[model samples]
Target chain A: MIARLRQTVWSGITARVRGTWDSVADAIRPAVPGFGTVRRGHVALVGVGPGAIDLLTLRALRCIEAADVILYDRLVEPEVVALAPRKARRIYVGKEVGAHAWPQPRIDAKIVEEAQKGLRVVRLKSGDPSIFGRVTEELTAVRAAGLAVEVVPGVTAACAAAAHMQLSLTERGVSDTLILTTGTCREGDPLPESALHARPGTNTVFYMSVRQAARIRDGLIARGVPDGARLRIAADVAKPGEQLLHCALRDLPDTLASSSISGCAILMLTWPKEVEALSDPTVATETVAPVSAANAPS
Target chain B: MIARLRQTVWSGITARVRGTWDSVADAIRPAVPGFGTVRRGHVALVGVGPGAIDLLTLRALRCIEAADVILYDRLVEPEVVALAPRKARRIYVGKEVGAHAWPQPRIDAKIVEEAQKGLRVVRLKSGDPSIFGRVTEELTAVRAAGLAVEVVPGVTAACAAAAHMQLSLTERGVSDTLILTTGTCREGDPLPESALHARPGTNTVFYMSVRQAARIRDGLIARGVPDGARLRIAADVAKPGEQLLHCALRDLPDTLASSSISGCAILMLTWPKEVEALSDPTVATETVAPVSAANAPS
Candidate 1:
């Protein structure tokens, strides 16, 4: 049966080739309207998961190795950058705090120039390239250049931190709605109302907004969310400095300030599984004994 | 500077060791807590990414290798399953339509039994093990069995499918919300109203939902989502047999039915990027098309 299927497919392909050549002679084909279009260099936007060598996708690794030049950032871990061939030209396009090192236009220009040189160029970012990674601007730039572009996804840090902490972002009847946003807003931009008005069974994850932890906590209080809602502050996820703090949002500001943890941080809030123990009559009292707060049920 | 910091940390650690355990008698006392005081055979719930070897994280790999027995399912690709050590006993807990799959309670019992035997066991699932993969139920069961539990996350398919298609779920001002939901509804449960009521700037992703494509499309249209909203569908992502179909939601049902796309599928909806062509004003009429329901935009 398999042999018959293969033979049938081969016959179909041969018939098409023969028919095309017969219909358009070589002389006439030379004058065809859409001939001799050259293929352009392709751009692959790849993600390096949360500063860890082992966390990178195999497909992402292959893309980086095949690239002629790699545009990387400080957010990408050193080990991940090492995956690229030694001969591949590397460029730093990272934007640090108070510094827009490479402006938008210039970065777009660099990508187009490399592609025009017929070189496969890769734009590498930390975590999943799509989430809060300014990928849309890069995509628009590449498309405008008429170059083919693809994106390789990576492991985002929220999942990494939550997994390591043995917590489910969407536990049944706990957190069904999961929201991903940044805690820091533009100078004139208002804070996210979703974080402020957190529903009982929803999980909110904040990326790249550690400095605004206090403001986030205050907003939740103002919106009537329980002050004792669980908050997980994870820093340097999947890296050596990896730290996971389990606390309530109300006290997160003080707790984080007391600790010297800085650098890229992810903040997560959800109705925690620990709270479910409050329903077990025998264990409810003991579970809430540790630190009862304003929202604790009587 | 790094070396100096390391030395300072070491000195502080040494000072604590000397100050806390000053006498031979103190050293002779139990150096650690009793073994039985803490339960053993804990379950480590893990996610292996969509059928690609590179998609699995180093942490997940380590956890899988450490397990004495592995309980895995069909969502886990064959290539990934091969990563488990040869000596480890692997058990099939796959759930397929009308298949003799192990019930949730049975799987939970198996984990506990193996863990009680002092064997490291991994409960592995495809995509992020925690996301709609029943990790929470397993966690609760394991904890109730008095076993320690840990979670190691992998890349979720929703993000991966989007990346593979070179599409961004959120594009700043273009889209503010990205919602991911499983396609299945419980017996007697009604469809989600929020999911049906599509917001223009919000992107929605559905998993395990290819069979419901027709119903999903109808639900969206009935809920007042613009009929011109674009839909991108991909099946068997990151694997050989992968197929992609791009079209508008209004036409998605017909497209899927005619295309005969089944098996693992990812569905994406996005508000088109509205851009004015730079080179020619005429291009505005050609490419800068209005997002009217009259045209299929995907």
Candidate 2:
């Protein structure tokens, strides 16, 4: 299969296929026809999962297999990009690991520019694009230029991290709400404050926030989040070199500073609704009711 | 590929893979050795996406293809279940479909029973199992009995619905936080309160909440969520008969009552942080700045 992808991608026949394939999460909207007989190319803003090839959704894979050009981010695995047809063009729009890297604006221009040439383009992102993927800029740019685009959702890192720990992000009584927020904000925008977030009865995951660990800790503390709130920090989620850490909210900064995960890590805090203090001395260190025989009622 | 899955699954090669597979998000855990060499079966709690088969993650498809005994819910598409090996036992534990339907507690018991028999059990749920999938009960049950289990995450419903609409769920300047909560609670559990949730500067998606439309609307309104806040309601996301509605928070109940979508629907509302009011009379009907050229600053 890998060899086939290479052959197809490098096959030297680069003709765009227009919605010919079935079962790949067909574009929700029909393509708007271009005026004056000018052919228009299609772009698929596909998420390739947190890191692992296995986490890649079938729809995302299908989009790559049928692409005439693939513009991928650094988070996408090289093996995944290798799956495109041999006759396809591959471009790197990520911050690292590519000879032909481009920034966000350039990517917007390139996607619209390439589509105008009537090529099948795939803008591959890492994880689901809906969260912290800078999706607003790209979607606006594409739609502004009157081209057809579709988003193929992929498994986000939080889910992958939860799965890796063999735990769920939200539990029945422990947490009824799940928040998908980011540690960092857009340039020139105000940094996210914990006072505005960090709800009780919630499991909040902060993406791209490892660098702001201290700020996050202080902010949550300022917002009156319990000092002993449970946090699950993970990096390189499903990819090799995976690291998992369990600590209290107060220990987050020290724990991360001493650990190896950087930049790519996700910070998840579970602040259970005010619950009875644990009477069992064995597990007294934790706050919420742990998912054990001791608390089987939840 | 479909034929290959059938062969591998139905081939009666039921011996557990035991972390032998190279990829496929190979369980992040090592097997706990059973005492006295009593062979133990494994259970994989897999999320099969909202409804579409293509939205299924490769890791999930791998689990299903390798399943020895498959227990699937109603939200999972039939084609997804059909991919399991013909020899593999396929059981339905859903309330709406199949003759072998069983309730939640029975499922917890059944999963433990099958895994103890040394079968590779796949407990398939719709959407990401981490969110409102009742994972606490299931995971606790499996572990209490000293069995091994893993979770394979899939694209959750909110992401899928956002993708289907060709829009990003979390857009800059418009919505900073994304909350994934549900409308209904457990039989004895207290219902989720919008006052505790429904924050400004947040985009909240309610899963399995169509039945609670009036309650959700009333609660949000009472909590100061603007009556004209933009809402996007979608049902049967990514599957046939998919329906989408865009309305104000106040009209949610009435709009849902007049729509074709019933059950299996998600409701999303974006209550922006206090922003400057628009002067244009045409699109003034909306509270937040539109995503058009008029509001591209975000």
lDDT of each: 0.65, 0.72
Task: Enumerate the candidates' DockQ scores in order.
Answer: 0.11, 0.20
What lDDT tens digits, residue by residue, belong to model 1 across residues A1-298?
4334333432332233233333433434465555423335888888888876657765676577667889987788766676666888998886676575787667778988898788889999788877767787888899998899988888888777877777776654444445676654334545443353243345677776677777877765543445665677899988878888867667888988887678598887774212321122222121101211222110
Against the hidden true structure, what lDDT does model 2 obtain?
0.72
Q: Pick the candidate with the highest lDDT.
A: 2
By DockQ thresholds, what CAPRI class is model 2? incorrect
Which tens-of-lDDT digit does each residue in B68-128 have in candidate 1? 7899987777656656667889999867766778888889888888888877888888888
Backbone clash pairs for candidate 1 read: A58-B54, B41-B115
Worst 10 residues of 1 chain A by lDDT: A283-292
Q: Residue B2 in candidate 1 has what lDDT?
A: 36
In model 2, the Cα lDDT at residue B64 comes to: 86
Tens-digit lDDT string for candidate 2 (A1-298): 4444333432211112122332122321233243124235888999888887768876787688878889987777787787787899998777653465677799999999998899888998888888777777888998899999899887888888888787778777667788888777667878766334665567888888888888987776554455576778988887767899878778888999899887888988876644322222222221211122221110
Chain A TM-scores of all predicted models: 0.74, 0.77
Query: What docking grade applies to model 1?
Result: incorrect
Query: In candidate 2, which residue ranges exceed 4 Å CA deviation?
Result: A1-40, A96-101, A276-298, B1-40, B96-101, B274-298
In Å, residue A251's CA in model 2 sits off its true spot by 1.7
